[model samples]
Target: MESDYQSLFQVRLANYDDIPAIMNITREAFVKYQQMSGVEKLAALEESYNDVKKDIDTKVVLLALSDGEPVGSVRVEVFPDKTAYLSRFAVKVTSQNNGIGKSIMNLVDKIMVKKGVTQIQLHTGSKITSLIRFYYGRGFYIDSTDKSRGYVRALLIKEYQKKDC
Candidate 1:
């Protein structure tokens, strides 16, 4: 029988108490990318618990849980121009490849739409082939790149357009 991840995982907005787990998961998730890119100082890996709490206070920090343990998380910070900056996306190293990241992205997209956002954007290490493929598969295209910026990341963007009948 196939596993029903929706039934197995709980998705919810994070609280201050969840910051430590969030930080740990984010750090662990980015370690592979760091190793791949030779960028040890990636901001995601250096995020402090307080920094996460600030995000919880200001933006959206969504988490997927398994029996109350945080397994995946992503942050969405909305801007004034109908754009949502999606960042700090991370899934537990052990919980990856199990559709957890997709679940989080789908949920976050819905959340953004409900918040009146028309565009979603994020940055990922350009050297990570899997990430580039995943983002492309999700309908995001490489909007631009600033190699001089942190870690030579790619700025990907996805726009939601309302259908006209």
Candidate 2:
């Protein structure tokens, strides 16, 4: 059976009441990372409703909907310098690999571009080759790596073309 994702999911900015669904998607999405890294408490899995609500107030939180149901989310923090940080990207386990992640990323890029951001940054586990490849395919490159926090993280950056949007 073919999944008709194009006709299924819609993306929109999230609201305060969507925090629980956001956390649920985040938790479900990070499970593989938790099992792979042998870390039981990934930051995404530990986020509080208050934390997410704060993000909703201060940052760009995008939600992907399936039949009006929340199925995925991504958060962005735009800085004073027009550089933005992307984080907590998640798609429900059942919705994975259906272009939901790619769609969210494309939506984020559009959102940042509209905000006049010149670049977007994000960090991921250094050991996660598949994730690195995913970001690479999206035009992000490793700007640096840090291990001082007791785990390796690859800092990736994607620069937007100069445009008057």
Candidate 3:
């Protein structure tokens, strides 16, 4: 029996072989955002296929596939503070607005909840307010702003608390 959203597509742990597809999506989505932000430092956030492959050992990469085609990807890393760092979430531009991003985020939220995480955190350039709003829609709130970094960005955190059982 498949979950309602399963649709013959599985969201599961990514492997080394998925790096190329993951990087392609990442570069395509973030490259232009980098250029338009007047922040050359955005170049530093890029992850090549090799770099993404290395992350497999330290982070959880979840890939969303439809009919065996890679359509989206997300990464979550748990810190010593028991908080999960969610980043590098990307979906093919053509696949936007189809709930792919939401599905990936939901999957990560469940995993973190099971792991006993108290919160999740992510950072994005302040200019990307839409992305921040997206997070907010997902129940996250801006925790602070860090102008001391390469570019003015907001640090957002989402607390995860189990509902009354």
Candidate 4:
């Protein structure tokens, strides 16, 4: 089925071939942010080939494609108890502010609802105020801040109480 954001792209589970292009988009976007902050030295930190490989092994990465070109992506790992952990949400810089992020997230919400998930959760750093605010705008609320995967980050959650089918 086509996502409501069909004009923007199709959001789907990532296939192996999409990883290289997904990594390229991620590197380009993050490196651009690094450059704009005059922290060009941090540009090298955007290397995501290995991270992409790991996410693929974990079966968590989702890719968004526009005309067969990689334009956006996010990853989420589902636990047995109907909660999911999301990470690495991104849209190619050129595609930002066009509702693609919201669209991709809405797609995930719907899918998780169907999967019987009761909530979705993720973490963002205090340094990324904009990202936190964005998640808030999407109905996520700050739950807490704690050591997540060795990094101090804010925990945010969005509960899903799907209507009966």
Give the per-residue Cα lDDT of candidate 3 at 154. 84
Residue 144 local lDDT, model 1: 86
Give the clashing pairs for model 4: none
How do the candidates rank by TM-score, highest first? 1, 2, 3, 4
Q: For residues 1-165, what per-residue lDDT tens digits would candidate 4 score against the true structure?
A: 757556646788887788888787777766654544434344235556777887888846788877777888888888999899987777899888777788889888877887888999987664466777789998999889875334456789999997976
**Candidates 2 and 4: which is better by lDDT?**
2
Return the TM-score for each candidate structure.
0.90, 0.90, 0.86, 0.77
**Poorly placed runs, candidate 1 (over 4 Å):** 1-6, 163-165
Clashes of each: 0, 0, 0, 0
> Which candidate would rank higher by lDDT, 1 or 2?
2
* Model 3 residue pairs with clashes: none
TM-score of 2: 0.90
Error of 2 at 62 (Å): 0.4
Candidate 3 per-residue C-alpha lDDT over 1-165 given as tens digits, one digit per residue, 9 for 90 to 100 = 455566766678899888888887777667755765557765426556677877887898999887788888888899888888887887777877777888888999989988889999988777786677788889989888887666777888999987789
For model 4, the local distance difference test gives: 0.76
Candidates arranged by lDDT, highest first: 2, 1, 3, 4
